[model samples]
Target chain A: MVSRGRPRDMQVDERVLRIAAALMLERGYAGLSIDEVAEQAGAAKTTLYRRWPTKDHLAVAVVARLQADDEIADTGDIRADLVNYLEKIAAGLNRMRAAGHRQGPSAGTVGELVAAAARHEDIGRLTREQYAERNALALALIERARVRGELRADLDAEALFDQMAGALYYRVMITGAPVDRAYAERLVSSALEGNLTCH
Target chain B: MVSRGRPRDMQVDERVLRIAAALMLERGYAGLSIDEVAEQAGAAKTTLYRRWPTKDHLAVAVVARLQADDEIADTGDIRADLVNYLEKIAAGLNRMRAAGHRQGPSAGTVGELVAAAARHEDIGRLTREQYAERNALALALIERARVRGELRADLDAEALFDQMAGALYYRVMITGAPVDRAYAERLVSSALEGNLTCH
Candidate 1:
C-alpha cells in the first residue's frame, strides 16, 4: 500500500541534487549522510527519502545532474574534441581536489567510492549505469571520428575509451601528478599517432 | 642526548620486516601499531622503537624490503618485459587486496596511505624514494631496449614508465577493472607501439 502524500515538485528535486553535489565535493561519499543532505538542502528528511532512499542512489542522481550540465564540444575534429574533453576532465578533477582538501575529504574520494562500489554488485551496477550515461556523448564523438576516418576503425571504442580516460585518472589518483591541458593534449595526440613516427 | 643501547642484530631487523609486511598486508598501515608488530615478531618494543621511531618509518622499511626482494624480468623484448612487470604488479595488488579484505583493512586502505603521503612532505619524500628504488630496474630495462634500437629513441623513458604502470594501477584502483595477464599484455603492447596504428 503506497501512501499518497504531497505531489513531488521538480524544483525541490533539483535543489536536493545541488546540495548532494556540494556535500559530495566537500565531504566525500564516505563522509556524507542522507540526514545532512536533507538539512543542507533545507528539505524535510521524508521528502529526500521519498526521492532517493540510499546514499548510493543520491550519489547517482548528483553525478547525473553534473554530467547533464556539462557541455561536450563538437568541433568536427577528433583531436580538438578529445583535447577539449580531457582538459575539462583535468580541470574538474583539480577543482574537486581543491574543494575536497579544504573540506576534510581528499579529491580521491570519488575514486574510492568507485572502488567500494566494485565490491557490491548492486552499487557497482548503478555506478556503471551512471558512468555510461555521462560518457555517452564522448562515446558518440569517438564514434563519429571513426566514421570520418580520423580514428583507427580497427580499434575497439571501449578499449580506446578505457586506455585514454582510465590512464589519466590512474595518474591523478595513484601518482598525484598534475593533469593539465598540455598533458591531456600529449596523451590524445600520442594515442592517435604511433610513437614511432617515420619523419 | 640520544640514549645509547646494545646495537640491534641485523637478523632481528629482517624478522621485523617480514612481520611488518604480513601485518601491513593484513591490517594496512593505519591498523598496524608498533606494539602489535613487536609482539607479532617476538621483538622487544625498545628494539623496534630504537630502529624506527614512528609507524611511518616502520611502514617505509616494510615497503623497502618488498622492493628489494622484488625481481623484475628482462626478456630482451620491451613488450615482454613490460608485460612481465605489469603482471607482477597486478599480482601484488590482487594479493594485497585479497589479504587485506580477509584479515584487517579494506582495499582502499593502501590508496589512503598513498594519498596521505602526497599531502605530507616527509612522507612524500619517503614514498618517492621507495618508487625510485623500484623503478630503477624498470628504467634499466627500458634503457637497454632504447640502446638496442627496439624502441623509439625519442620516447621519454620516465613518461612511458609512468603511463604504463600508472595506467594499470589506475584501472585497478579507480575503474575497478580486473588487471589480469591478458589486460597487462594489451596495455604493454599498445603503450609500446602507441595506442593507434595507421596502416
Candidate 2:
C-alpha cells in the first residue's frame, strides 16, 4: 500500500487516533476491523495500512495518543503528584464504567483488546511498550520527589508504580468497582503512611 | 430436579473444586462445559449442576476453594506477612501461566465468563461476593497489623488492600508479569515506607 502522502496538518493524525480510541473502547480489539476504522476516519484503507501495518500498530498508535492526552502533573511534592495521578485513574475508571453501561459498541472493548494482546505476541509487545511508557512517567514523578526529599530515598519507584496502577486497574477490570477519588486518595495516603512498617 | 443422596465425605466436593480450578486455568472460562467438567472429573452432570447451576457458579466455587487454601502468614511482623503473601501470589501466577499456555479445551473461557458476568445480574452478584470475600481477607490482615502497631494507625485498610491486591492482579491479568516475591516485597515496603510522614 502506498501512502496517499502525509496529510497537510497534524490534526488529521490526531483525529484518526481519536477515532481509533473510541472504536476500540466501544467494540473491543477482536471486534475492530480495518474497514470500520477507515470508514470511521473517512480515510482510505490504503492510507491506514500505509501508516499502520497491523491492528497492533493501530492500537499502539491509539494508546500513544491517549497517553499523550493524559496530563502528567509535577507539583514538586510526591504526595500531591500522586494525588493527581490517582485522580486521573479514578476519572479513567469512571469513564470506562460509564461507557460500559451506555450499551454502546464500545463497552468492554478496551479490556477485550488488552486481553487479545495478552495472547498475541506482536500485540502483546506493543501493549507492553504502552504500559512501560506510562510506567516510566510514573517513575519520573517518583524520582523527582525522592530527589526533593519528599519520598523515601530507598523506595523502589517501579514497584510503587506497579502497586498504585495495579490496584486501580484490578479494581476497575476485575472487581468492577467505581475507583472513585476518595479511593485514590486512600491508596496514595496509605502508601505514604507505611502499611508494613510502624511510623 | 430430584435430590440425590449426599456423599459420605466432603472429599468429593474438594475433588470437584480442584478439577474445576485446573479446567478453568487450562481452558479459560468460556471453554468450560458441563460435559467437559464431568468428563474430566468422572462425575455425573447431574451432580456437577446440582452443586453449581452455571459455569459462573462452578468458577466461583473453584476460586473460593483456592482462597481457602491460601494461607496468609501472620508472623507478627507486617513485612514478613507481606513477603509470605507475595510468595503465594507468585506461585499462583506461575501456575496460571503454565496452565494458560497449554491450549486446553477451555482457552479464553475465563475472560468470556467474566465478560458475560458483566451483563448478568446473578452471575455478577456471585462474582462480586467472591471478590469481596478475598478483599475482606486482605483487609483483615491489614487491620490486624494496625491493631498490633505494625501499620500506621490512621491508614485506610480498604484502600491499602485495594492497592496491594489490585497491583498484583493487574500485572497478572493485564500486563502479563511474573509478580514474584521480590516484586511483592518491594510493593509492600514502598507503600509502607513511602506513605509514612516520618517522625
Candidate 3:
C-alpha cells in the first residue's frame, strides 16, 4: 500500500535533516551543497531533491528542527516564565551565532537564512507562518498571565514579547552582542518594571 | 594635488551611490551590478572599485548614507524624542520593505544587506561600528533622562533602547508586521510603562 512507506519516510526525513544541520553548522550557508548532502547521506539525488527541492529548503528545515526542540513552560510565575522562554530563544540564537565556524558575532547562518527567505517568496511565507505559530504560543502565555492579574490588564503583550525577543535578535544580528540567560533576566526585569519613576 | 581632487571625488561617490541605490531598490539586490552603477554614474570602473572595492562595500555605503540622514534629536522630553527617533527608523524600514519591487512583507534588500554584512568580515565590523555610534546617541539620551529623574535610577537603559529598536527590526525581518509611527508610539509606551500590575 502507498501508506506502507510512511514510517520509513519519516525516518529518512529525520536522518537527512540531521545530516544537513551538521553540514550547515560546520561549513556555513555558502559551504552547504545539495549534492554533497545527498552523497553524504547515501540517498538518491532525486530523492533528496524531491523532498527538499533546494538547499534553502533543506537549511530551513534543519533550523526549524532546532527550534522545535525549544519548548515553552508556563510555570505560573510570569517573570520566571518569561525569563525561561527568553533564555530558550537566546540559546537558539547563540547556537546560530556560533554556526558555520563563525569567529565573532556576525549573525552567522541566521543572516543568510533571512536573506534566503527574501530571495524565495515561498520560503518567506513559510518562515513567517512558522514564526506566527511560534509567536502565538508565547502570546497565549502572556495572555494567561494578564488574565490572572499578574500583569496589567491594559499591557501591550505583543510589544512586550517583541521587546524581549527583539533585543535578543538585535544583539545577535545588529550589535554583535551576546544573548544569554543573564541578559534574558535583565530584559524581563526591564519589561516588567516600568522605567518611569514611580508616582 | 590630492586635495584638488577631493571635492570631485566626493561628487562622484554621491552620484554612484544614488544610482546604485536606485538600481537596488528598483530591481532588488541581484539586479544591482557594480559595472552598471559605474556606467550610470559616468565614473570609471577603477575609480568605483578603488573607493568601494566590492558590491557589498558600495551597498553598505549606500545604506550608511541613508542612515546618516536620520539624526537623533535630544528634545529634553525623552518620551517625545524617543518616539520621534523611532518613527524615523520605522520610516527607513518601511522604505526598505518596499524596495526592489517587493510585493509583500518580505524584508527585501534589508535582509540582503544583513547577509552581506555576515558574509564579509570587514563589512560586518564596519556596520557594527556605525550602529554603535548611532546607538550611543540614543543611549546618551536615555542616560540624560535617568540622571534628571525622568526615568528610574536602576532602569536598564541599554535594554530599553534595544527593546524599542529591536522591535522595529524584528517586525521588519521576522514578523512581516508593519512598523510605523503608530507602532513606534506603542513600543515606546510599552517600554516606558512596565507590564506588571500596580500594587
Top lDDT model: 3
DockQ of 1: 0.28
Name the docking class for model 3. high
User: All models, DockQ values?
Assistant: 0.28, 0.41, 0.86
TM-score of chain A of each: 0.79, 0.78, 0.95
Model 3 TM-score, all chains together? 0.97
lDDT of 1 at A47: 85
In every candidate, how many clashes are there?
A: 0, 24, 2
DockQ, Cα level, model 3? 0.86
The stretch of ten residues in a row with the least summed lDDT in candidate 1 chain B is B102-111
lDDT (Cα, tens digit) per residue for candidate 3, span B1-199: 3586889888988899899889877887788899999999988999999988888888889888877889889878989999999999998877777777777899888888888888899999999999999999999999999999999999988999999999999988988888988999999999998899999
- Each model's TM-score? 0.74, 0.78, 0.97
Interface RMSD of 1: 3.8
**Least accurate stretch of 10 residues (summed lDDT) in model 1 chain A?**
A99-108
Alpha-carbon shift of residue A30 in model 2 (angstroms) = 9.2
Off by over 4 Å in 2: A1-17, A20-64, A100-110, A196-199, B1-20, B24-35, B41-61, B102-121, B195-199
Local accuracy of candidate 2 as per-residue lDDT tens digits, A1-199 = 8565555436557777888878766754555577788888788888788877778678657755655656788977777778788788667655544442444222244454454454455666666767677777888988888777777777777777777787777676667666767777777777776655442
